[model samples]
Target: MALDKHSDTFSLQRRNQNGSTAPLTNWGFRNETDPLTDVLLGSPAHLFHRATSSLSRKHLREAPCNIQVAQAQHAELVSTYKHFNVNVHMLEPEPELTMQVYSRDSSVMTPYGAFITAMSQWWRRGENYAAIRAYEKLGIPIYDMVTAGTFEGGDFNVIEEGCVLIGCGDARTNEPGARQVAGWFEAEGWEVRLAFIDEYYVHIDLMVVPIAEKLTAVCLACTEPGIVEWLEAKGHEIIDVPFPQTMALGCNLMSLGNDKVIAPTSSTYLIDQLRARGFEVAAVETAEISKTGGGIHCMAQALRRGD
Candidate 1:
């Protein structure tokens, strides 16, 4: 299929043409908290790796991930996605990159198409090419590629239709790359907010997450006060997740939209808080897998999210 020049954005639907369902030509997403229709998950076949990030390195030095246990945990994550009726797509394995299981860092999904990322770590850079191959195989459009500086998809969060919050710690995503992303979104009429987080936190998703239309979970101890105030001013109810749990990836829960969320079972505090708010929660155990430095949100990339 060719690019639809007349259409403003690519469609994710497999349209029924004539008597058969036509192949998908494009896939896109606008926000994080939407009914997840399609997602990209990483394979466990190549997930065995030593600690790369500062956070994971500490624990990895003490005790590295048990490959078998990590693989089982990963399968549970995939099963959870399937149980929710989400269309799961896997990236082809890159044997040399063990941290590739955190597929969220490979690329950012936008309403226009995919923004292929530039990984900061040398060993993990190959994941970008794998993401490109996945997009091509799925027939998704490539909106842009970050060549200015290092940028990872985990730092790009679509908070609303016309608003995005990006994090730059100079490690995962640098100022140059963040500026480039901001410019692209601004040109498309989006109000982009830049959050400069501590490098230890890795990505903004680790500090702040949107779970519903006007509800967000934030790690108050680490998040900037201005960002919290801004979110509150926008009518977003902030749920403060404890610092200890935040370190455990508590704030990294995935929103399935319509007041539904998928979280890690180890994050009891977040699970209880989400439940108290009457949101449906699907909690999966990621104790073994998370030792590699990410949570459920980092493991899956949304391809299509419903408004």
Candidate 2:
């Protein structure tokens, strides 16, 4: 359906004039009432990373010259997306670029639309605008702009049905960013809590992710007692990620509806834990992708949730 000229709320699926549902797959509608219904998260490979960086003097490290490895990882990522029956959109890299774009800011989804964030890293700053243009080109609405607050989409997490947990730290996202999102969620009558983790934690999703309704994946190493208590208060069952596995991004698994997860093949323990929970798990090797310090959850964001 066509969207209003001035509004960002547009439909990617065709609409039925006679009050019937559109034919854009059973789970493809962007439901305004259920904001999580049509949102999606993705990582751009355009920028990988450097071992260390400082605004003053930044060190640059090029991804392995082996195009084969990059292609292989992309292929794996594409298959993962297809496995979940979602669309996969890749961003082409511009020449003379530094750093890889594995963590393309954060993936922000709202009832009105999806707003991809700008990269906090100076070299990757342009990425946010690029993501915005892409969503606009695809007819996705912009819920809000994170201009004053530099936030990455990775830190945003929905712990319970209506409550969201956002992290503020590191160079990626800060207090201003958390407050920015808090304002937006508050405007919608949703509950948001700001969790202050050390900079080593990066994004909230890095340490915590919801694998299924009432089920959460967390790195026992990075999770705080208070956070655990909070999750318990919300009646969420925790699937712990062992320290080694967590470092390998084992906790970064993504949920595919009920009792199923998309995880990295390298993370044996995490996959086993998921299976123990009766989840049908799919494991793909993400060595190259994980080099940038994120796994399935970091590489992808869920835009839709099924009831």
Candidate 3:
């Protein structure tokens, strides 16, 4: 798949005409736990507090998010990424896209290319189009777009190089959408597992996220036993994050590879565990912005990792 950087003639679907799609030479990554070289982030300048989920709704009922504080927290997060020597790319902010701060929900970066997701919320649907524009500006070719049904990028969990654990939360990512994505990877000869979760969880990353090559952080209290067993069968060391912390988006963290991670400060359990293990953890405060619905990982989209 050759991407024309000088013009807007890049292919919309970069997947091979044949079953095996070749990985992009200059972009994309084989796995999540690779030294991150580039990341895509959205500006919190237009961020607004809305009832995007049960958690956000509760926060709104209790105390709405402080917009100024949220923007400052986002700046701190950007600084953390810069401190780690990772290149950060920001999406053009649109005033109407209040939830655009969560960049991970618009599209997913994979070895093949960017997979544009279908936004479940009416207000967020513009994000899909915005994602395409962002990719174009970055000179990244899109592998494909989800059309079977609604599927957000948060539900697309790439567990390893070729294996993926897709989440199907009826409200956000429906069964049809999950299977559609599963079928694409199946054709590419990758292992695909579908985990059906409750709507309240919003996304799979809320309860399960990969920490390293063979380490995963999971909320055992909420994750299904079968999923846990499957991970264990694959020799993955599970670090069980407590239920309360998980609800606070403790498990939703970004693995920068090379034993480094970016996590939310409120997730003390996960931060402590990572620190004890000698992992260089950049704990950024996200409590204010998270009230608008998303954490650290939700705010980023890995563009390139490990050459």
Query: C-alpha displacement of 210 in model 3, angstroms?
Result: 0.6
Candidate 3 has which clashing residue pairs, if any?
none
Q: Superposing all C-alpha atoms, what RMSD in Å does each candidate have to the true structure? A: 5.4, 6.4, 2.3
Model 3, residue 305: distance off in Å is: 0.4
lDDT values, one for every candidate: 0.83, 0.61, 0.90
Residue 271 C-alpha lDDT in model 2: 81
Q: Flag the better candidate by lDDT, 1 or 3.
A: 3
lDDT of 2 by residue, 228-264 (tens): 8888888888888887777667777766664667788
Pick the TM-score winner: 3
How well is each residue in 1-307 modelled by candidate 1, as lDDT tens digits? 9645324343332222222322223466667887999999888787765666787897788878888998998898888888989999999886787888899998887776777889998888999888888887887766778879999988998777779999999988999999988887776667999999989999999989888888888999999999999999999998899998888898998998888899988788889988988989998888778888898889889998876
How do these models rank on lDDT, best leading?
3, 1, 2
Question: Sort by TM-score, best first: what order?
Answer: 3, 1, 2
105: Cα error in model 1, Å: 0.6
| Candidate 3, 1-307: lDDT as tens digits | 6554323234688765445877777888888899999999999988989999999999999999999999999999999999999999999999989999999999999877898999999999999899999998887888889999999989988888899999999899999898988898998899999999999999999998999999999999999999999999999999999999899888989999999999988889888988999999999888999999888889999999993
Candidate 2 has its poorest 10 consecutive residues by lDDT at 28-37
